[model samples]
Target: MIGRWIFIRGQAMGRRGWLALAALFIVALIVLMPLRMILGLTMPETITARSVEGSVWGGRIGDLNAGPLPLGTVDAGLEPLPLLIGRPQFAIARDGFSATIAPSRIIHANGSVQIPDGLGGLPVTSVGLGDFSAAMADGQCTEAQGTLSLTLAALGPLLPDAITVSGQARCEKGALVVPMRGPQGMERLTLKIGGDGRWQADLTLAGLPQETVEALKSSGFDTRPGGIGIGTSGTF
Candidate 1:
């Protein structure tokens, strides 16, 4: 008789625990319904969201876009249990990309960004080098893994006849220095970005052959002591 009573008590406690968990889940859903609705309606002009529905604990954003960049759609949800215990957490995934976002720069993450053809309206494109120098150089390229900023004025010094410069590189950050040699001798084109995210450029031409220097001058470029100066700015 005593053993049977003990077993019955244990089963009852288990039932109570499960019932409590179910109650909390319902409460969480109710509390987060309004917030999820607000986020859906307030989607920023810079971003477009599709099929945004679900409570806080679980939800899906079908597709998203910002300017020329496409973020596709993703499924995401809030994880309040971990957050309540002092660990901020969330989840995201879209086709080939997946990551668990948290504080501390990054943790428990693995993903890759893909550009099938290339980004639009920007300086460098996969198939084209539009708006950049037409200079007939060896067509050098750097890592495509970082941010590149530059002004259009920096590209004009290229020989006008030259067009459609193409090379291979991985994406990356830092100034893009193009090495070109001609009658002006050896020099580099350095494109720098300002803290304000503006593009500026300089021609590091020094000790150029006089014939080449004069040629650049005649091409509508102003000469500094050591190099030719050129540049371009927004909406170029």
Candidate 2:
């Protein structure tokens, strides 16, 4: 009788051990699932990519684009700790720059991206962001902090040489605003981005020679008493 009791107890314990191991296996499988499987469900509509390959813990996104700007190929991964608390976060890195993205905000390190289509109607060559961050609520900007730089490409000899301007980024009336000025402070550019991905850019050149002003006017700029202004708007 004693022997039978001991045997029965041993069998039950072994079954319990196996059940625990099976449970752990299932959890591991779910945690390391491929990103391609869940990308459509987790990715934001404002961001798109040509291809996603690898597991959620670590993956590569090909030909990624933020609005209309290209981000090239980037390494990305999901933060598991955030998901446990119901707040999903994504970490992205490319060209030695990194950023963290949450549902309503994004934090960036120093980085620059080439503007293939320029900005609005201006022939912008590139954009550089330094410690830039922005938060949004209800389709509008709630907070914006950082510095921004833009390189305006020269339009041959008809226009001045390529010039870069630096300025602060801030929140203005719920829109994210960036005001950049060249070294001489004669060249200015303002950019605004809405939460819905719509954007507009305005460039003004002041104190230029009359000859140069006429050249700019011929290049589609509007002649104004203050200076020559060029404006364009589009959806990201």
What does candidate 1's lDDT look like per residue over 1-236, in tens digits? 99999789767777778798899998876667743464444333444566677765577766644222344677766557775786644465677555443331122323333334332222322222222221111222222222222221222354433212222222124323433233434444444322223444444456656776777677555777667644434311
How high is the lDDT of residue 225 in model 1? 62
Candidate 1 weakest lDDT stretch, 10 residues? 128-137
Backbone clash count for every predicted candidate, in the order shown: 13, 0
TM-score of predicted structure 1: 0.35
Estimated TM-score per prediction? 0.35, 0.87
RMSD of 2: 4.2
lDDT of each: 0.44, 0.83
Candidate 2 overall lDDT versus native: 0.83
Error of 2 at 120 (Å): 2.5
Task: Report the C-alpha lDDT of model 2 over 78-117, residue by residue, as the tens digit.
Answer: 8888788887677889984677776667776468888888
Model 1 segments more than 4 A misplaced: 1-35, 38-45, 66-68, 81-90, 100-236
